[model samples]
Target: MRPARQTALEKVLPQIAIESPEAALDFPFTPEKVWLEIGFGNGDALAHWHHEFPNTGFIGCEPFINGVSNFCKLVANDDLKNIRIWNDIAQPLMAALPDASIDRVYLLNSDPWPKKRHHRRRVIQQESLDTLWRIMKPGALLILTTDHQSLAEWMLEQTLRHSKFEWTAKCKADWQTPPEGWLTTRYEGKGAVAGRSQVYLTFRKVDCE
Candidate 1:
């Protein structure tokens, strides 16, 4: 969020243009899956997901330097090699991704951007959804997690209306439960300590019938 940090990212980050998350990965044969975590604050869930799914290549974007440093410490401690970083707005990065390329997408506990006027900044908007769908392979997952009920409902409704995405909740438990190996992030823990509820949403990309 600092001006200096923004300048640093612009200077050091590589511009690997892939056109889709699926295309961002380098492995072959297994159709190497690419999963993205936008605004990975403190990077706990991203780190855990890396260990759990070793074959999956991950791209994590966060504009916050402090959070990036916290994530770097964990990456160093864990000796992880499957993750890459982009310290800027994820939309431009998404633009570089290949169409129908990403296997799964994660947007967990993003800043609510609360005020009605500032809601435009929320990533769950139509433009964001279009960009998200453009990169995801058919049947690929788009996972959203939030403790903010209003935002959660809004995202659910908006994403559900997208012809390319299909929400996968068959029962209440699916909405209430967290995904596998979903380690608590700093925000998630704070919410829990505050007695707030968390919701997990899964949407599959649908294409070509």
Candidate 2:
């Protein structure tokens, strides 16, 4: 972690970090809705969303220390009151959350883990989706974006294989373009500069019959 960010995290984390499942239940202010962002690299989108939805509480999980520090700096600088941080793996945090707790989730430009042997390390897998399905409220949205073609297909296939989710895209443009009010991240900007297209996929959690 950078020195400045580390210092900022030390000061702000005690106030904004969600330490346990019990804390998450009443995070920040217990707003009408809760959103989760896993692997919020550098926190540009997370901060943007928090700014846009002051009434909704946000829980952002990032295992990388640098990212966590940067995110903490944003929270401190903006004095964003409705956001909480989990500076650890998302699975444990997900497990800590109660059933039907999350209203929205963002998994954007996650590490592709391109190697075949490393595919299991990718976040958009069966187990992760199953947990997400369990925690998400009925009709809640899961928004995923990736510039890697294989990863995009993998996400689509994994989500489609799960019976709990329904794809919201009716046409190509729906996935081709970023969703309305989209907050573009640094990684997304780099992908665009490289002429690589990013896919935006939204899946709605549904009740299982």
The local distance difference test score of each candidate is 0.77, 0.89
In angstroms, how far off is 71's CA in candidate 2?
1.4
Per-residue alpha-carbon lDDT of candidate 2 for residues 155-187, written as tens digits (9 for 90 to 100): 999999987899999999999999988889999
lDDT of 1 by residue, 1-209 (tens): 56554453444333322334444455432426778889998888887887888877788888777777666655554534567777667888888787877888999998887788888888898889998888888889999999998789889988977767888999999989987666888898999899999999999888853
lDDT of 1 at 137: 86
Clashes of 2: 0
Instruction: Compute the lDDT of residue 153 as modeled in candidate 1.
Output: 80
Model 1: number of backbone collisions? 7
Where model 1 places Cα greater than 4 Å from the true spot, the runs are: 1-31, 77-80
RMSD of 1: 4.6
TM-score of each: 0.84, 0.95
